[model samples]
Target chain A: MNNYSTFGTALHRLAILCYVLFALFPLFWLLKVSVTPNDLLYSEGVRMWPSRMSFEHFRFVLAHSAFPVFFRNSMIVAGATAVIVTLLASLSGYALSRFTFRGKYWLVALMLLTQMFPLVMLVAPIFKMLSPLGLTNSLTGLVVVYTAFNIPFATFLMQSFFDGIPKELEEAAKIDGATQFMAFRQIVLPLTLPGIAATLGFVFTAAWSELLFALMLISGNSAATFPVGLLTFVSKFSVDFGQMMAAGVLALIPACLFFLFIQRYLVQGLTAGAVKG
Target chain B: MVFDATAGFPESRRRSLVDRITRHAEPYLYTAPALILIVTIMLAPLVLGLSYAFRDVHLLNPFSGGYVGLDHFRTLYDDDNFYRALRNTLWWTGASVLLQFVFGLILALLLDRPFAGRAIAQALVFLPWAVPTFLTGLNWAWLFNPVIGPLPHWLYALGLMNEPANILSNPQLAMWGPIIANVWWGIPFFAITLLAALQAIPRDLYEAAAIDGAGAFRRFTSITLPFLAPTIAITVLLRTVWISNFADLIIVMTSGGPADRTQIVASYIFTQAFRALDFGYASAIALVLLVLLLAYSMLIVMLRQVLMDRA
Candidate 1:
């Protein structure tokens, strides 16, 4: 029976391996297309490795194309949104998780209500509202829209994080003659590092890749993000798969680096060994 | 502040009053940033959009438009395009969320047990979630390119279709194509959430089942499932709300195109305001969409509560 179970475990391991490969194939394909020399792209006939690989597309995208500007714009928008949304969400999440006020339930109900609407529905009205203020063509406008869209979800995220922390810690701090602000800043915020990191990463990635609002709000190259930059690969006639794939690969670095930086916080449990078993 | 507010009261009154006020006030202060932003950015726009629904305004007459009081809604109700957008939006949300959750759960379950190379496997499975949506959409676009795409080329080679075809140009299939991409993009979220929940479940229950001579299927149903119910339900609720509001995927992949066949409420509303310059009517349509969204969310919350109670 033990031997049979060992066999079963091995089979399970194999199954997991297959599943993982399947899940990652698209990413593998992304890397493949990004590196395959354009001359050999079609000639290679679905070969996993091209006879020759080139960084020429990346070189052109970085040096010759407007991709660098798009990259800079994306970083600014995403970074600002992440910081702004995380700050707001941490505060709001704390409120939702801890408080009982006159309109607490209704406030939550309203926030949830805001999330239900397809944001596309608000696009025109938002543009109309922003256009007159000369905010439509600016990165600030994109950041504002992304922050608005991300905060509700990020708030929920933060609230759950705060919820995971013990209220006893804050209570103990208050008894020690700490103000609410002091207790939160000194005690609670440190414990919520994991949650803060998660929120930051979530909002950062969200703002980074946001295409719809960027496409609609930003009219020119000055404010355009990488997603809109990818669209430039498609003119009226044919799509440039090689350069587009290369650009897609390049656009991935910031998101990858952001995750790498945050992965520690993403997995860590700041509340670990805090409370008694 | 609470102590100050209660300092005027008698000794007995002061303690209770201050405690009460502080208990109530703390949450507000903690959540003030989120509240202020949500109110100003999200709620304000919602209110502003609703007001636009009542006006007879065009793009040129943003502030000077006359209040028409539901005329735009009436036009929306009478419009065939609205119905099509409504139906497509429903289909997009329903199909995308259901498939994503189902596939995600399956993947999560398959990967739940500790095994060799589990960490690497988990990372690879979660890769799609880390990659940006724009890149995924762009990559999928390349994969769907008829002449150049591997899918059509392989299909043609296998005699599945007559020629390399532009799937996005087909009115009927464009929405589904984007839905597929969206589902692929979202599956990792479901997988991660469910996996977290699954990991939290105690191993003792499975041990109890093993002692009872329960097979894998029996253990899953009897021990694993009932425990994971709340997490699964919440995951479904979150995914449904999110998928329903998905405008980005459609924007990148289809743009509600090939003769408005893929026009979900979000994309269609965008066209009205940004492309068509119909601000008043667009706002009216947005209002309707918001109401429907609220109704759906309420249903999910209520359903979740009912299920939690039962479980």
Candidate 2:
């Protein structure tokens, strides 16, 4: 509707192209160096593409390293955290959305306060607390920590989604002799699938990329998550750039898969609501 | 369609005593599991961490759990490194947030306009946020390397530098290394949120304004800016708090190094607790940080309230 001049339009597209390049260039270089053979790495001298590319680095990382175990551990922790956080967020979010209760405003304020606190404050105490219970250095401990860390934001996110659905649908279900919980399960949840998917993706990627706590809590090879593993790999190999970048690419795959889901719902105004539906 | 008629029925349902009690308890029931977990996992640890600031609780020393009232705080008062970290924290948070917001807003405005291949472009541009922070730090660090990476070479050729050198090593410029990487990683976050808020804007408002002879700039100022104000305010406020607390990029890229020029309070706290095993000192710094952050949040909130009341 605001289309005015071709010159203006060209400038806008050019600006967009710049952003895309700026966003992708670092990642592109990651892939470039990861594939470039060691001899060509220094010899080629900053060529955009390698003179000859090979999978030697990728092969080495996958075959001769603890990365695979770390990868699995990270997946399990992130996946479990996402599922648990989403489930709990859905319930709490539903309460915030649909009910008028005592202390509701305080509940909201408390959640916001949680967000404001420096998470670093909790690291030492959390380690100390978990150590006595034999929960330190375990995947379960990581999952529990991650779930609590993510809940406040996820609750807010899911609440926004729940607010978007019209109340009429659930009321109709209730009028037909269905309970509130039943209506919520059968009628409300199906419509909020997109919202749920987005929350899952957000929380999963957060737990996956979390470094500070993971590094503090876990030690040794068996239970190490990918971020911890990546750091250790760097020090152990002593600047093997190709193998490091190769491991970095491998670490990015799950996030990329979930990114597809996030973008789809995110552009749809985060839910199938009437205003932007 | 059948729901519409019942939606107007406001009398609520008849209920027995048990049902009334259940109805009163319903929201609590729904929220209990989450609330319990959060209290135990996050809230309790936070309280414990604060108390640790007053005691000597070294992790390795079995005899270290002793009351040491005000000792840590007294040391913090005199610590030169702590003061330096505070100064650096301000710089890092200010520069990172400002740059990210400006670039992110521009990106959002660009993406908001309809164009061919917009979906693909949006996805591609947002891809940086998906790259984990650790990798982002490592990747940017590598890019600034003088040998394998092209950036130092490009800067030298452009006469920005006399010789190809890594800015990550220069104490004066070391902080920029992480700030630049942070902007790249975090812009997509701001863009995604702003774009969502932008899309929620009523399209007809713009159309009506145009028909009334308002120019593009005038319409944006009178309409778009007003609509975007709340999102912009909350995002910037929360992001400021978050970015200040964020230490991963600094730790990964520079390790707060090159003569400790890049050391932020958050990274300093992490290093103390994680590397030094000095829980008492780490918790002490963390408490100060927590107080400062809380005060900052309170100030903004009150300021916003006053502004809203005026408006």
TM-score of candidate 1 relative to the true fold: 0.87
Q: Against the hidden true structure, what lDDT does model 1 obtain? A: 0.77
Which residue pairs clash in candidate 1?
A91-B31, A92-B31
TM-scores of chain A, one for each prediction: 0.88, 0.93
For residues A1-277, write the lDDT of model 2, one tens digit per residue. Answer: 4566887999999999999999999999999999999999998888999989899999999999989999999999999999999999999999999999998898888898888788988889999999998788999999999999999899998998899899999999988988889988999999999889889999999999999999999989899999999998887875699999999999989989988767766657632342544
Q: Write the per-residue lDDT of candidate 1 for residues A144-261, one digit (tens) a residue.
A: 8888889889988888888888999999998998877788889999999977987898899888888777877888788888888777555422445667678888888878787666
Clash pairs, candidate 2, are none
lDDT tens per residue, model 1, B158-178: 997687776788786777778
Question: Taking the true A–B contacts (Cα pairs closer than 8 Å), what share appears in each candidate?
Answer: 0.62, 0.70
**Candidate 2 residue spans exceeding 4 A from truth:** A1-4, A270-277, B1-15, B208-214
iRMSD computed for candidate 2: 1.9
Q: Give the residue spans of candidate 1 off by over 4 A.
A: A1-11, A95-101, A167-177, A233-238, A260-277, B1-30, B60-64, B298-311
DockQ of 1: 0.51
